[model samples]
Target: MNYLCEMSEDKSANEVRKIIHVDMDAFYASVEQMDNPDLIGKPIAVGGSKLRGVVAAASYEARKFGVKSAMPSSMAARLCPELIFVRPRFDRYQEISHQIRAIFYEYTDLVEPLSLDEAFLDVTTNKKGIQSATLLAKEIRERIYQEVGLRASAGISINKFTAKVASDVNKPNGQLTVIPEEVETFLEKLPIDRFFGIGKVTATKMKELGVRTGKDLKQKSIDFLNQHFGKQGLHFYNIVRGIQYSKVKPNRIRKSFAVEHTYFSEIYSKRKILENLEQIALDLERRMKKKSVSGKCVSIKIKYADFTQQTRAKTVLEYMSTKEEFFPLIELLVEHLEINKPVRLLGISFSKLNTEETELDQDKQLTLQF
Candidate 1:
């Protein structure tokens, strides 16, 4: 069924900004695959194998043989003897990226492109004039698939830092979101390396300092972190606590959200699963409030014992009005369940929020996506 949300005019509501990071899957390689049907399943490399030349893109198949973009062509050749190298088609790839951007503009005027293959968009006030960010995302992805014939992954969050990282998690045509309400727990289970700004050097130092996940960093005093990393200490302190007040700059959209949970003995009970729903609901609610916004739609995600996952969401009558009110509706949704199998994880999301700062147009366009 098509996803839908109903939202009243939130004229009194404060606006919450968003940053969405989008990346083309295998970029040039994917383009090649789309152009030539034969290359779809083959180990295709779009670049030179000559001395000093670099690979631009490698199909997923080619990646299995250790081929990677921006890597020396010689290394790629040495790793995969059967690799089929193709020259870069600048015009074609550029055309594809351009088409993708046009779709983005449909959502928001605040678009900041990172590179030919990636971009960040601030959809607080979308051009399509839709209020639900998730629904807009679904529409965007569908458009890219139909119009560009390429798969793109997206990461969405209240800020740029986490959103950029979220896009890379379930890559190659996947879209993920990290709701502000769930930021803390989301970061708690997150690996340190995945945290924004925790690069190789920082990651090493973080390990030494006992700062592993965002939650671990939360344990340290802000002053303590400042002593070790100087200005970055304050930065770490904020992000670890999921306090990314950062805006979705039009020029630098990176990626989307990351969400996972810890399990005790890999649970598999419906009642227990419903109980966990409250935790995820709380998490999502907190993240949303921190960003000073609410979503118009709620989704319940389930991960079964076999690792199979299914998600169901209903567009709501309003943005998350209050946590006290939101949880019960989620409870009602849980009752609609009919999973005959054991459950592992249960997640709930409030999306398609009316959080943008724009005058409500009389010509509202209703769409089903969030």
Candidate 2:
């Protein structure tokens, strides 16, 4: 896809920020392939087996067969009959993630981790004194591969939104850069669905409204967009114009800790569901203890086979961290759920944490600082 756009003569006099978004290529699947030499170049899925499991990640080879993460394993197996399924090793993934973050610290401390596999970095004033953001991205990617044996793709631009969208343009060990002057045209031609916050549902809605690309979106007035998308309409309005000002915050606080799992098959038996919930509780307890924090509220999420989901939460008088202390509460919560239908997923989470409580506003919008 062509990413170039005609440059505007009058560039903004404001200080142009340098942002880079780095995303690991098929992270979990890649790790599986890297550790297992025999799995190289083979179509493998890092998840559960075909009968009753869900896919966590799929290697590029498997992707050719239309397999994807979060897809049901049975469908993935049908798509690629030769697909190999392997369980995810999150501990190992976390270990490697730390190594990659350390490399980012070598250049800039303004690293904002979105997940274990992706992050946003602000390197406008990097410690390395590198004038070119593209070169810095290349160096970071090279270091990750050489040191950690994983391939990564990067996108370099003047802001986080453009940089993030550019990262996916070239994938599986490639990089893309969207210079400031080209940002307008680059966004105009971009597919509506390709924008960072627009998902399938919203993209379908936009297409129904004759907004197929960024150019079409830009044609709508802020009032029109707001009328349709509510508050997010303002977000859509600004992003299409390359007007994003969200900073790459390095020290983002963690609000909650949770653990969840999708079963290989629909579980009909309450006893079986309880068994799974017990294991989930144990896992969550371990994570809480590791962080040395306890929470007053316990929450459980249940997803039925029909794709419907519900969450139930209860707050206790005192902080609790042990499985023994919370498992009974979980049982009580499960009793209230509509389990007449078979359950496909179960999760447990702890909130109202004993750690410093920061009431983060979910809808807070950020503007340009300087």
Candidate 3:
């Protein structure tokens, strides 16, 4: 079919789509709980307990006491004096993540992973030929529990945003489906804060402007919103009208591979900066190989102590995958830049991607885990 005809067919298909958003319940903390029965039903957090450290994940029990992920551990401690803290086991989590991803692939290839814990799946045309999305969601959740021993919440809707929001409506081992006919009503009653992409600051600003709910937001003129919130204003306008058109990208194609590190203290020594750059190059090399991608363009980003940032780039003669080929260009780029102030951050990225997927054995994939 021609591209335009295909798009017209896609639009019609979308009207009856079966998009499912699946989110693992308290993934990190739940993994910790499942491995240790003694930790079940107890207030536990997975992350460092040091004053400067942040909570990586909080169990449902800890959440009752106002402890949440990314909150300072000290604050979490104050919230629940008897809170038990466990260090994050990222390798274990990643392994479980891959296992869960395997289950997703059994259902549909149109899976877009939002994180290690959540994903969006377009199952309109699924392998199982299941007609009802609600039934498919139930089966998926059941399989996850039986196979992975983890509870997953699911949401089914005609589009991604609605499906994502509905997933949270009934969380921690629950599911909800919003049918095509109810899309407008569902969004209208939803609080502005509950809409994806509208953060605390924006929510507060919206409240002050009488944009308290999707219904309120829908009443505002696009030009007025555009004048106030720039391009995002138009986005808000469209989504409130149930007009989100983003697709589920399964391959998870990456445009660039990069690694960055921020130093607590600024460094003026050229030797220290170069050392950091070299390390970053190695890290980027590992990331690229993991994703099975390389690029012809290379770039380096430098942030000064004053928070000023600059990026320098070069289109190399060939696609480069190893750090050895890119290190010399990185050095040259750093040398060419004006460095009157100490450096606070350094980063390296490779763009203009080569799309060929790298075939790796199971052992190689395991070794490539970050």
Q: Which candidate number would show the highest TM-score if scored against the true structure?
A: 2
- Give all candidates' CA lDDT scores: 0.72, 0.88, 0.85
Top lDDT hit:
2
lDDT of residue 341 for candidate 2: 87
Q: Estimate, for each residue in 1-370, the C-alpha lDDT of model 2 and write its tens digit.
A: 2111222222442768999999999999999999999999999999879775778899999999999987888899999999999988889999999999999999999999999999999999999999999999999999999999999999999888999999999998999999998998999999999999899999999999999999999999878987999978778887788876677889766677889888767898878989999999888888888988788899999887667889999999988999999889999987876678888899999888876443333323222332
Measured on C-alpha atoms, candidate 1 has an lDDT of: 0.72
In model 2, state the lDDT of residue 23. 99
Q: Any idea what lDDT model 3 has? A: 0.85
Model 2 clash pairs are 52-264, 53-264
Single out the weakest 10-residue window by summed lDDT for candidate 2.
1-10
Candidate 1, residues 141-255, lDDT tens digits: the string is: 8889999898888888776777787888888788988887876777788888987667899999989989777778879886798799986777777665655554545533112
lDDT of 3 by residue, 1-370 (tens): 2222222323654356779999999999999999999999999988757443467799999999999986767789999998999988878999999999999999899999988999999999999999899999999999999999999999999888899989999988999999888988999999999998899999999999999999999999877887889878777877777676678889766677788776545678767888999998998999888877799889999877555789999997789989888899998888887777878679999888775334235447879895
Per-candidate TM-scores read: 0.60, 0.89, 0.78
lDDT measured at residue 261 in model 1 versus the true structure, 0 to 100: 48
| Backbone collisions counted per model | 26, 2, 0
User: How accurate locally is residue 260 in candidate 2, as Cα lDDT from 0 to 100?
Assistant: 88
Model 3 TM-score is 0.78
